[model samples]
Target: MYLNQHEIKSLLNKSFDNFVDFVNTLPDIRFTASPYGKWSAGQQLDHLTKSIRPISSALGFPKVTLRYFGISQRPSRSFDQLVTDYQRVLNGGFKTTRAYMPGVIYPSQRPALLQNFLLQKNKLTVKLLGWSEKDLDKYRLPHPLLGKITVREMLYYIAHHNEHHLAKLKDQELQGYTWQNQLQQLIF
Candidate 1:
């Protein structure tokens, strides 16, 4: 529920580490293969890197500048609540915005993508540690899908978001399952 910076950091590290380990082990062909025209593992990694870069950059800004977004009026949501909200949105057919989408990621880019993701993740961890627990709950950041959420909630979302993509990548059954097929099945 209430995760202090250290706890949040640990969760973030574990999720990211697990996701990276799984992805790194995939063969070049597997990494580049876009199952059913969806994102390939490399594309997912690229998307993740794109998603995290901004959070780390934003956190480095002075607290005064962050106030431009204002503070949270209510308490931060628990991790489960945030995940549930995210899942509900996903189920409702929420698609990622253009800025967060990944381009065609080549297998050759895996190492660089991993390196960049680690850099962004580490910066985020450091920035998070720089804040007090109270400040974490007090400050707000605008998330495209979740709207304005507290810093803590954002961390929770990051952790779960990494796991979410990891699960998708790991699902062998997803290889041939396309959204269009799912929709066609529903139509008939």
Candidate 2:
């Protein structure tokens, strides 16, 4: 669906708010814990950080690649690793591009890795708001996994991804509480 700037901004704001709420609900320790064997909290945050990079780039000025991650082989790097690597690079004023081709790796990480995920998310939201409809369409990018996604699709995926993770985190929280209650009754 094609979203006007206002609609995109609203969705981005809401999505970011939901992500913040989800993060707040977690215990500090859980920030380092992997909800599943596959991904840690830090990794998830890192993923979010990297996810916004393309949007940020698109919003900054006119570019060939819009609404999608750049046309690079770096898809092999998980968003988490890229965040960690990029965080360091960003700190030093040195930007690094992905070294490999797209679709080569499964991205994963712990939450502690991305301290500014929410902030970056907000920046991206603002960026989306400034985009013209034509720019959004012109920069239609393809996802290695999803394939040929428009800018609107990319925005939807951002919110959808956050929601998917939030649900997983909530499930983990509920399961922990249930387990704790069961253990308490047994101990008592």
lDDT of 1 by residue, 31-145 (tens): 8777667788898889998898888898899998989889879998888899999999899998999999999888789999999988888998888878999988899989998
Backbone clash total for model 2 is 11
- What is candidate 2's local distance difference test score? 0.55
Q: After superposition, how far is residue 115 of candidate 2 from its true place, in Å?
A: 4.6
Q: Estimate every model's Cα lDDT from 0 to 1.
A: 0.86, 0.55
Candidate 2 lDDT tens digits, 144-171: 4445555655666666666655666667
User: Candidate 1 versus the native: TM-score?
Assistant: 0.91
Steric overlap count per candidate: 0, 11
Candidate 1, pairs of clashing residues: none
Candidate 2 C-alpha RMSD relative to the actual structure: 11.5
